[model samples]
Each structure stands twice: as C-alpha cells, then as structure tokens.
Target: MYTDQLKRKLIIKKPIQRIVSLVPSQTELLIDLGLEEKVVGITKFCIHPYYLKQNKKIVGGTKNIKINVIKKLNPDIILCNKEENTEEIVAECEKIAPVHVSDIYTLDDCLELIHQYGNLFNCRTEADKITQKINFKLNDFKTFIHNMPKKKVAYFIWRNPWMVAGNNNFINHLLTLNNFDNIYNSKSRYPEIELKKIRLEGDPDFVLLSSEPYPFKEEHAFEIGRFTHHAKTIFVDGEMFSWYGSRLLKAFDYFKKLHNRII
Candidate 1:
C-alpha cells in the first residue's frame, strides 16, 4: 500500500506493467523514466514525443476523458495531476485501477514528483539522472539570472475570457524562478481579468502571451500591446513556463534566451 501526493491510499502491485497517463507532462516523464513500453494509454495532448499518440491509445483530453477506453486498457495504475485533472476524474479512475496523483506547485515539488515516480516504477536510476540534469541546468540558470533585474509581467493564458496565470500555480512558480514578477500574483490560480483592469491596476512591464491553450499569434500580441500600451507584448512558449517535467531540461535554456531577447 502507498499514498499519492494528494494523500490518497493506493494498493499498487510491484513490477507494474501497464500504465494510463492522463497528464501530458507526466506522460513525458514516464517515457524519460524508461517506462514507455508500460504506457498503454495517453491523452490527446500528450504530444511531447510527437509519436506517442500514434502508438498509444488516446484518452480524450485533460478536461474530458474517455472512461470506457481507459476501462478497456486495463492499466495497472492510472497517473494524474491535481491541476491537470479534476477530482471527479480521479474518483472515476480509482474504480478501475490504483491512481497516483501528483500535485506540483514548485520546482522542488516537481523534483519530488520525479523521485516518487522512481520509487513507484522501480526506475530510481533513471529518475535520479533526470533530476540531476534538471538541477544542473537550474543552477546554471540561477547563476545566469542572479544579477538580472526583476521584471513585472502579466502572463496571459487565454483570450476569449481573458485569463491569466495567477499565484499558487506551477506557472507562477516558474515565473518567480525566472525573476519575473507576475502582476496577478495576489490572485489564486488562473483568473480572468478585464482589459480595463489590466490597463488600470496591472501596469506590467511586459504582457506575455502563451503559445498554448489559445495560441497567441503576433497579431494578438499587437492587439494586447495596444491595450497595455506601456508594456511590451511577446509570445512565449507555454511549455517552458507551464510544462513541469523532463521539458524543464530545455526550458531553462529557453528562459535564458528569452531574458536576453527581452533585455
């Protein structure tokens, strides 16, 4: 018997052979941990490897999942995340197999998740290697950004409702590590903001438009720049700011380049 990050008790059998990964980042981590063969099912958004969807069964999406398909997969364990998946989905998956839910809000939390995966899947060696690389890159980034001045910014995640990354989330955690002060740090999680409010209260130095969830193009940047006339609007890779897994190995370098470009 074992407990997940959410403190849910699970009876997981060793030598776990089958897996159903509902989160994209976790799916990628599983691959990095050399559990690719064990991953029987993955969501449509798990596109990191670019070839996973072609081989693995597609399980609807992060918000919506095909329960029937998961039931048929007959996975030994179902992997999920606190933010990427909902409580209802976790409850449903529990009926099919032991569910391991990870709740990550910081870099430390992400490292811990990797360690947990190591113990769970008997891949401690692979997990350690990944974490070591992340730490190496992370420390280098820290040294590179140590002297850089902190910049205030508003990170927009959506447009139709005008949502932005707020406090107490992985995005915000990474933003802080990059020395970017989120204008909405006072608010919890992702929050919707009015353009008027952005212009009035959040006088940010930059308006970062994410390249996922909404695909903010150059025209969108220009449109947002018009509203936040004082701030520079730039399209940033959502994966770098949000994806908290093996991708972080590349994300630190991306952040360094982004800072240099913006500077």
Candidate 2:
C-alpha cells in the first residue's frame, strides 16, 4: 500500500517501471531522480530535458489530458499537481491507474514532494541528492539575501486580461523567499486587475514580467512601465521562480543574480 500527498491509497507494483507525469516540474524531477526510462507519458508542456517530447508519449496537457493516449502507455502510476491539474483530471486518471496529487506552496512542501517521490519510485538516493543540493543552495541564498533591502513587486504572470501572482501560491512563496513583497498579496490566487488601478495601490518598486504562462516579452515591460512609471519593469525567468523540484538546485543562484540586478 502506498499513500500520495493527497492521502489517497494506491497499490503499486514493485520495481515500478512505467510512469505518467502530468506536471512539468515533476516530469523534470522524475528524470533527475533517475526515472527517465520509467516515464512513459508526459504532458505537451513537459518541455524540460528538451528531448523529452521526442521520446515520451504526449498526453495532451495539464488541464486537457488525452485519456486514450495515457491508456496506450499503460503506466504503473500517474502524477499530478493540485494547481496545475484539475479534479476532473484526477477522477479520470483514477479510472486508469493510481493518481498521486501534490499540493506545493512553501519550500517545505517541495521537499516533502521530493521525499514522497523518493519513497514512491524507489529512488531514495537520487532524491536525497537533489534535495540536499536544493537545501544547500537555499541556505546560501538566505545568507546572500539577508543584507539586501526588501522591495515591493507586482509579479505579472499573464497579460490581455492581466493576471498577477497573488497570495497562497508557489510564485508568491518564492517572491517572499526572495524578500520581494508582492503588492497583490491580499488577492486570492491569480487575480485579474485593471492596469489603471495599479497606480492607486501605490506604484510598486518593481514590475516583474514572467517568461512563462504568458511569455511576457521586452515590449510587455515597456507597456507595463507606462502604467507604473515609478516602478522598474524587469523580465524574470518564470521557471526559476515557479518550478519546484530538482530545479530548486539552480533557483537559488538565479535569485542571487536577480537580486543583484535589481540592486
């Protein structure tokens, strides 16, 4: 008997050889944990390790899964995330195989997810190595950021309707870790707001445009800069801030560079 982050029970076979990963971060983590060969299915968004799309079965996307494709893969287990995937997806996956859903917010939650994957995939050593590297970088980042002045930021994830990273999410958690106070922290999840209203809240110190989710380009920075002329509009790597897994091993270093750039 195996338990998932959602406390769901699953009967997994020993020497687990087949896997279906719904989350991009976890897909990358699975590969880093030395389960590359075991991954039989991956979402179209699972672009990490670049060549993954070439070898693995494409299972549609995080929200819209191709059930027929997953069935063909015949994976031993399926992995999903609370934020990236939906309840409907979980229910659908349950019909085919056991589903493990992970809900991550803080760094602790990320560590727990890695530890859980370690236990589930029988890759405790590789998992531990990844976690240790992340922790080491985390500690180093803490020291690096200790002397830096905290800046209030508006971290934008999307445009058009214009959604910004809000409270209780991984991006906001990472912002907090980087000592960047999120101006929209009071809002729930990803909140859509009017551009004109940004000035009313008192222009933030920075307007960070994320690379993913919306693919905010240099032009978007200039557009956002027009709204909050006082704020410095900068483009940030969404993966470094948003990805929770072995990716954290590289995130701390990115944070240091980001902080220095801002300073």
Candidate 3:
C-alpha cells in the first residue's frame, strides 16, 4: 500500500496492469517502455507512436478528464503531470486509483521522473536505456552547437494573451543548453507580455513560436516580424521543447535539425 500527501491510499497488491494516462508525454513513455498492452486509457492529446491513436481508448483532456469514463475503465493506475494537469483532476483520479504525479521543470526533473516511472512499471532496464539515449543525444546537440554564437531568443507559447517561456521552464533550459540566451531570464516560468512591451524592450535575436497551447503559423511570424525587424522568427515543435517523457528520445534529432537550419 502507498499513501500520498493527500492521504490517498493506493493498494498495490500487484503490479499495475490497466493504466490510464492523463498526460500525453507519459502515455508516450509507456509505449516506449513496451507497456503498450498495459495502457488501456489515454488522453486524446497522446498522439505519438501513431498506433496509440488507433488502439487506445480516449479518456479526455488533462484538465477536463471524463471521470465517469475513467471510472468505467477501472484503471489500476493513472499517470499525470503537475504543470500540464490540474489539481482538481488529480485529486478526483486519486479517489479512483493510484495516481502518480510527475512534476518536471528541468533536465534533472525529467531524468528522475523517468527513473521513478521505471520503478513503478518494473521496466528499470528499459528506463536505463532510454535515459542513456536521451543523455547521449542531448550531449551530441550540445557539442554540435557549442561553438555557435549564443543568440538571445524568446519562445512564445500563446497568442492574444501573449505568453513567453522564461527561466526555469523546460524550453528555456533547452534553449540555454543549445547555446541560446533566453531574453526573459529574469522572469521565472512562463509569463504573459503585452505586444507593445515586446516591441519596446523585448528585442530578442530570435522569436520561436510553438505549435501547442497555441498553434503559431507563418502569419504570426509576419505579424511579430513587423515589431522586431532584426529577429528571425520560426515555428518550433512544442513537444520537442516541452514534452519531458519518452518523446525526448526523438527530440535530440529534431533539435539538431533546427540548429542546422539556424546556423
């Protein structure tokens, strides 16, 4: 039996077999760890591995999960993320089954989460291989971009509200690792900034628009280009920069490609 801070008692008489994933990244991680048969329920956003879309049952979004549907599925375990999911959803799911909440903001957090998941799923060997692969790839990217000039960059996640990734975020960490300076390093986490202020002082060398939380297109680039004439604007994969689970295995190759385009 396992008890969390909320005093949610988890009676794990046996290893978790029927698992439901509220978070997309963790769903992908389960697949990567060869637990595809165990993952019975997953969010619609868990689109990676392609086969999951055709095979797994859809539970709902991280924020708006169908509790009734989840109850019906009778999952032995549920996987979630702290930032991507809401506290209410986690609490609700805890009442039904053992819910493992992953709180990741840095590379270390990601590695720890991977190891934790490995322990929970009895896939320690696979987890080690995945971790080694991610480390090797990230190091390769770091080496490839080590000599490049560190240009200041602003990574946008939303529009209308206009949010930018700041220090302590996974994206910001990746940017720093890739030798890019995040202009909003003073600010902690993601912050909403007015376009007027961005024009006046937030003059970053590069503007990267993400494809999740808000889908930024070529038109947005042209729109932002009007204000920051000197900055190079490009669309970035939000999953590569934000997804902290098994998706990271493929992110290094993506980052390398992006770096090549920039240099």
Candidate 4:
C-alpha cells in the first residue's frame, strides 16, 4: 500500500480486475496501459479509444459522476484526478473501492502518474513504453524550442463568460514548452476576464482557443478577434494542450506545426 496524490494509502493486495475511471485523460491512459478488459466503467467524456463508450458503462460526466451506478458496478479500483473529480465523489467511490487520486501539474507529474498506473495495474512494460515515448518527444520538442523565440500567448478554455488558462496548470506547461509565454502567467488557474479590454498594450501575440469544455470554433475565434485586433486567433486541439495521458505522444508534432505558424 502506497500514498496517492491525496496521500491516501490504496490497498490493492490482489490483482485489480474491475476498474472505474472517473477522468477522461486517465481513461485514455487505462487503454494505453492495456487495461481495456479491466476498465468496466468510464465517464461519457472518455471518448478516446472511441469504441470505449459503446462497450463500457459510462457512469457520468467528469464533474457529475452517477454514484449509484458506480456502487452497482462494484469496482475493485477507481481512478480519479484531483482537478477533474471532487472530494465528495472520491469519498463515495472509496466506499465502493480503493480510489487512487492523481494531482497533475506538470509533464513530469503526468509521466509519474503513468508510472504509478503501471504499478497499480501490473502493466509495467506497456506503461514504460508510453512514458519513454513521451520523454523522447519532450526532449525532441525541447531541442526545437531551444531555437525558438518566446511568444506571448493567451489560451482560452471557455467562452461566454470568457475564461483563460493561467499559471501553474498543465495547459500552461505545454504553452511554456512551446515557448509560447502565457500572458496570464500573473494569474493562477483559469480566470474570468474581460475580452473587450484586449488592447495592444501587453496583449498576447496569439489567442489560442481550445476545442473542449467550451468547444471554441473557427467562428468563435473570429468573434473574439473583433475585440482583440492585437492578437492572431487560432483554434487548437484541446486534448494536445490539456490531456496529460497517452494523447501526449502526439502533442509534440502538433506543437511543432503550431510553432512554425507563428512569425
């Protein structure tokens, strides 16, 4: 038994057979970890491995998990995240099985989680392959990044009320890796701000709109452009920027393409 991100010791004396993953990113990881048969439940948002939803029982969305459905599932282990799941849900899940919570803030944290998942699921070789791939890509991206100039950027995850990814988060970490300096680095986490006030003064060089949580479209970027003429708006894959799982294996290529787009 060892401590998870929440410092809760998870007792998995026997092999983990049935698992309920509460996070989409982690759900994708379970697939990468070769635990497809073991994963009996996942959220509706666990759309990666696309057939997963059709085959597995979806407990609910990330923010709102169906507790009764989870209890009925009688999972031996529940995979969750500190940011994606609530404490109350964790408690309820613990009642059914050992809930291992992950707190991911950086690329290292993501790799570490993958490592831990390997230990948890008895898939060490596969997990090592995944992390190795991620590390190789990270280093390759770093080499490319070393030659690039730092670009000021504003990454938006939501619309309507207008919220942007700030400091000390996974999205910001990717932004940093790309040498895309976050203009909102002064702020922590996602912050609601007035898009109408986007002036030329200290404004971002680019306004990146994510395709998840809010699903910002090409039209949305154009709409935001009217308010901020200083920044060139672009629609980016939400998964590449936010997903801290096996999806990261493809992020560096996307990042390289994105980096080439900027002057």
State each model's C-alpha RMSD to the native: 1.0, 1.0, 2.2, 1.3
Worst 10 residues of 3 by lDDT: 1-10
lDDT of 2 by residue, 84-153 (tens): 9999999999898888999999999999999999999888998899888989899999999998888989
Candidates 2 and 3, the one with greater lDDT: 2
State TM-scores per candidate.
0.97, 0.97, 0.93, 0.96
Q: Which residue window of length 10 is worst by lDDT in model 2?
A: 6-15
Off by over 4 Å in 3: 1-11
Candidate 2: residue 72 lDDT (0-100):
87
- Number of backbone collisions per candidate, in order? 0, 0, 0, 0
**What TM-score does candidate 1 get on C-alpha atoms?**
0.97
What lDDT score belongs to each candidate, Candidate 1 first? Answer: 0.91, 0.91, 0.84, 0.88
Compute the lDDT of residue 163 as modeled in candidate 4.
95
lDDT of 2 at 139: 93
Clashing residue pairs for model 3? none
